[model samples]
Target: MREQFPLQQEVTFELARDVGIRHPQVSGSFQVMSSNFLVNSFDPALPKFVLQAKYAKDLSDPRTVEKLELEQRYWEHKNVPWFLVTEKEISRTASQNIE
Candidate 1:
């Protein structure tokens, strides 16, 4: 059976306090699609995704980098996929569609 999970935006977690992150831009879970038995064998609640959005210019800041690293480690420890999205990487077409 398939279940739907709502996308959470601008969410803060308790771990954010420890990691010095004010909040993450987006986070959610989705079903994993795989034909391999091992890939699909995990508990249903385990897979999740995190997205942190920043301006391209902010990526060079030391504080930003440090906070991002801490956030990455927090997600890594929990075995979730974490991604950093900068303005440069965003496509105008995608943004329009999302709107």
Candidate 2:
């Protein structure tokens, strides 16, 4: 098995509502994508958006899900919130911790 995997385009942008911008009601999106790099270079007001996304089909495998989690933690450590957007409405629903 390889430690590094291919990069991807995985991002679905949502309307800010605070300001009208980009496409509205974007679909089949990911905060990030396959085969992408995290580049930090841009205006402060209009900072660059670093995207990171994986495919839903991968979730079927427990190993893939674990790998995704690892990636999520990596982004979080860098102070970036890795958001996921899926067409599956059920997946969109928040999980109940009930704690």
Candidate 3:
């Protein structure tokens, strides 16, 4: 039988500490089920990935863009796939079901 590993959600990483920095303001918040989904894999060969969700209109904001870039960089440093998910990508039925 194959060993099963459950997917993890809302994973947060301490970037400053990992990179040998002690900056108080430098932190990473990967919140899932609302704005982002940080999926982790127990298998060493499998890479972890992130799914960030945002409204179509919100994507145009400068702050949002900056946040997205930071997230992309964080994932890239770890060699993980980062995906953007907009409201248009989510089905109404599925959203309702989740709610």
Note each model's CA RMSD in angstroms.
10.9, 16.1, 8.4
Which RMSD does model 3 reach against the true structure?
8.4
Give lDDT tens digits, candidate 2, residues 1-51.
112333322221222222232322237443341213454546675343344
Report the C-alpha lDDT of model 1 over 6-99, residue by residue, as the tens digit. 2222222455556665543426553221111112225667455666767889988986776567556655755766667776787999978879
| Clash pairs, model 1 backbone | none
The clash number for model 1 is 0
lDDT for model 2, on a 0 to 1 scale?
0.41
The TM-score of candidate 1 is: 0.50
* lDDT for each candidate structure: 0.54, 0.41, 0.57
Q: TM-scores of the models, in the given order?
A: 0.50, 0.38, 0.57
- Please count the clashing residue pairs in each candidate, in the order shown: 0, 15, 0
Residue clash pairs of candidate 3: none
Give Cα distance to truth, residue 19, candidate 2, Å.
Answer: 39
**Which prediction has the highest lDDT against the true structure?**
3
Candidate 3 stretches with Cα past 4 Å from truth are 1-35, 41-47
